[model samples]
Target: MKAEGGTTCGNSTKNDSTEEVKNQYHYPLTLPNYTKAEGGTTWKDKEQVFDKAPKRIMANTRPAAELLLHLGLGDKIVGVGADFGAPDKTVEKEYSKLNILSDKYVGKEVVLGTNPDLVFGRGGLFDNSDGRVGTVDTLNEMGINTYVLESSVTGGTYTSIYKDIKNLGKIFNVQDKAENFIKELKGRQEFISTKLSSIKEEKTFAYLHITDPKELNVEPAHDETFFNDVFKMVKLDNVFKNETGEVSVETLINANPDVLIIPDWNTYDGSSANKMKEALYANPKLSSMKAIKNKQIYAVDFNYMFGYSYNAIDGMDILAKEMYPDLFK
Candidate 1:
């Protein structure tokens, strides 16, 4: 079995995470309390499960679209959601690196215009309130199969990506592809763990989600299912380990973390991470923090880390290299 799509390599490692992955592979989805997103549904247990391959599918995010191609289900995909086939990018320019999907079909529209029988969202919350593709439940009720990537469930882990691929494979009747995909991902994780296993030092780290001039929504340790495994895998301390609840600028400054893992998403100055780095350096109050002073603040890619897709292996590798440059080199 061979994996279709994986990490966008940038001089990374190759190693065996098989044993470690087997030991810590399964991460349970206990569900989280959401303020804005959908709530009160037993998704892990009661959600709709697909029995056969869906035709005329809508891949809502780039990662979702990528997963379709990886599964060799590109032909089944009627609409490529999340701006992949937008007017600006031609099919050639959009998927130049993905040889498998080079000649496959792609849609320029985001929603209903394609009239899809199924919709795949990277996250759990997608209500009709947004007025784009309609809610998952609505689609499901209308006889259209819908699935929320397990990773998008708040409190999901790296295992969520594997679980999603596996579940999707079962749904699409392609179990072989899912198993191979997980194998490849574990290999990538092993690559990072083997290279940086010698380190015992634990640096206090925080994942700043939104970095506006006034405030930032930081993922505290209590609610960080994703980053906890990531930081632990690389042997780094999470700053918010002892605390929970919403994070503010004052809280971050007071904690004075050893490293700042800013997952930048906004599209400003090429990428928001660079923009965030600039903002932190210029801010008089934040400039004095330990992470800022030592220049240990790293602006990481959003989808690679927070995207909660198969790209998580790439996220893990990025963190390891950033945390231990000497070891990787």
Candidate 2:
């Protein structure tokens, strides 16, 4: 027998006479690929286990939307939750073509209207909200299958991304596409790693969120967050390594790292990058820090640094090159 793609299976290839060809040809035919393997089995029957790609998929968060686009499944997406940012001009154009609106769904009516076969989301997007849009129970009650990407779970690393991609591929019946995407992503990560590995001097950095003049939050580098991974790759010491979750402004002032990294600062809001720096300078306690005194503060794209998508690698590259220009050069 042969699979639909014209690959031989079962008893092997046969000539026009329907006789087994044997190993007579210069190139022997390899056994058909099977999903499962057993011990001491000469050959197993090949089966196309899954079919019928998901017709309508609702992405509950920005990272999921980005991942789907990276996986070449953006066209399959029927709906996307709000908060997906299209910063790059090319990506913005593509997003416009897809008609992905960054609007929140207050009820299931819009999602149900799409008639989605599957719903994809990170746990927080559903959990942190009022449980109205993409909750598992709600979707299941509507006869829609829901899949949590799992990478949204805290402590997710590169390995988690690979596993999530594979799982998604299996669900969507696009394993080959998923494998190819993983290969490309992994290759890029490896290249970044190789570029950073030779650095002789590493900088000590701190990630600070300037909520206001009186309030600030600090994320430690060893907290298993995406930012943590990026800092680790560039061999920077995160001053907040001892703490998990957020920290007070006093803690940041005390740590006073070599490089101060801020996110979400360059917006229309009052906390623009320049304003944050000004605030830092005005604060006598923080102004004494080496980083502040030397003007070593840097701002990153808030969405990219906070998000765990292909862009996280981009963020890593930017941080690595910025922190150690000589090595990257």
Candidate 3:
């Protein structure tokens, strides 16, 4: 059968026999003389592959940190977002010396001063409505090519993150590094998938984002949230499957997941983790949930969950091991 772009990988309509057409003059072939060509002053000889590298790059999100690290071009960074949490100790120390965090979002003037060749970040960061620091149009007008990694628009996953890295590598002409990075991440994912597949009983889970003092937003596992992807990868059923987009406390109480994954507790103080547990346990309506009763509630770093990168792999491993020790062990 013909593929989406009218390209066939296997037997074509013209070549009905199972015999493979190894010539450049085949019916489906668009480019002629591609196979018969020899080393000469041809199109391939004159084709100019760009060796020019981007002098400076500005990252406006946390995921960019991983991509930049993988590229091993951290020195090219003229400015980084306040939220770019580098896990590498060497990079972190170098970044601290740069003292770029004090200004939060690097001003357009500061970025311009650095003369960045490219600006990479999530598209949402450019929104002026929610106090966005920069704009793609503004950067474009100033002759700076800006790439808003589209992986963040959908659910973040290891596949998506790898795609992002590959895309960046293509743009930066670092395809070799990108391929190696993807291979490593895929190996890790396969290892985790194999381990979890052995488990007979998969635990039900609910992930919540506590945005306010009294409000708990239940994140559905099958929706746009990346955490859902993590849970599904480990064969865990999301209790709030029916719910969509920031579920209410009533929904949380109704579904009552076997385990609740609390993301981002840095905003609270005074034994906030304990208090969150206590509050859930003390609540007459929610106290009966199996998760609360068994004290299975867990908190993870906000950066690990929210940021779209290999960090999610870390979060997945942590969650999987916590929820099912028998499988992960």
Candidate 4:
């Protein structure tokens, strides 16, 4: 699925000098005594059992494709479509090697041409009425299994993401890899939780979307459910939790969250997260806000804030480290 709203493109970039420096600090250390493990929920109720592993798979998004690669299923992917945003640092090499079905969303005919036994992506890729990749039922009738990330269906949360990962593991018969990966992610989550356990108060944060560089008008991202869950993990609260429609600058100034989470929309020309930061700095009305005064603003890649994928855990890690550097150290 595309980044929420037609005007913006969500992804991360390495070329930005500011982004470069922020990537330097890794999560300090996982606590040795944090004993909680991820729940043992299976995907039986959410998905069907595959007769055999799908050999020729067509991944409908960059996140879906990269997750497959991480699962050691790279050879099984016949083609990738709708790879939005900057590539993740961990999977860039493997992602570069995949066949590109389309730079944007692939059409139904193109998906059919690929002759994939399985097509996996977010729910947006299989919209029947919109005519993008058609419905899951249509694909199923054509003898192709369609798997939509459960996170997408359930309004996006880490729990739903885990389910999707577990389901994919069962589909490909790679339960060991899936379990191992989930364990690592859960460890990261526990690390963040353990670090923040000492905090007495929570900081307020807003995830902003800047569509026009010159105008500098910001809107709340559409995927608040996932980001909200991530924020809760890091001890940051969403100021716009009850908000609806376009959030005016006046409202933003009045709310004045402790931190501002902005997206790095790398897909557009002459538009970047740095520009949004600059725009925020230039605005006189926004100067009085605590996020500006304390310099707690962050510009993250689209995937970290909005994309439906397990790498969102990595994004959560980034935010946690940024907000509480001492905890990680």
Assess every candidate by TM-score: 0.73, 0.72, 0.71, 0.78
- The TM-score obtained by model 1 is 0.73
Ranked candidates, highest lDDT first: 4, 1, 2, 3
Encode model 2's per-residue lDDT on 178-284: one tens digit a residue.
Answer: 99989987897888788877766667888776566456567665544545656666677677766856677777777768898877544324346667767876777
The true-versus-predicted C-alpha distance at residue 15 of model 4, in Å, is: 46
Q: Please report how far candidate 2 places residue 248 from its true position, in Å.
A: 2.5
> Candidate 2: TM-score?
0.72
lDDT of 2 at 190: 85
What lDDT, from 0 to 1, does candidate 3 have? 0.60
Candidate 3: misplaced stretches above 4 Å? Answer: 1-51, 84-99, 102-113, 200-202, 211-214, 219-225, 241-246, 266-275
Candidate 4 lDDT by residue in tens digits, 52-160? 6788998888888998988878888988887776577787898888998877788778888889988887665565543367666677778877787766543567787
Indicate whether candidate 1 or candidate 2 has the larger lDDT.
1
Q: Once superposed on the true structure, which residue ranges of model 2 sit more than 4 Å away at CA?
A: 1-52, 86-92, 103-110, 200-202, 211-214, 219-224, 241-246, 265-275
**How accurate locally is residue 310 in candidate 1, as Cα lDDT from 0 to 100?**
70
- For every model shown, the clashing-pair count is 1, 0, 0, 0
Candidate 4, residue 139: how far the Cα is off, in Å: 1.4
Q: lDDT per residue, candidate 1, 298-325, as tens digits?
A: 7666666555677656556776787679
Query: How would you encode candidate 3's per-residue C-alpha lDDT over 31-74 as one tens digit per residue?
Result: 11111012221111111122244658877754565467667656
Single out the weakest 10-residue window by summed lDDT for candidate 1. Answer: 27-36
Computed on alpha carbons, the lDDT of every model, listed in order, comes to 0.62, 0.61, 0.60, 0.71
Q: Which residue pairs show backbone clashes in model 3? A: none
Ranking according to TM-score, highest score first = 4, 1, 2, 3
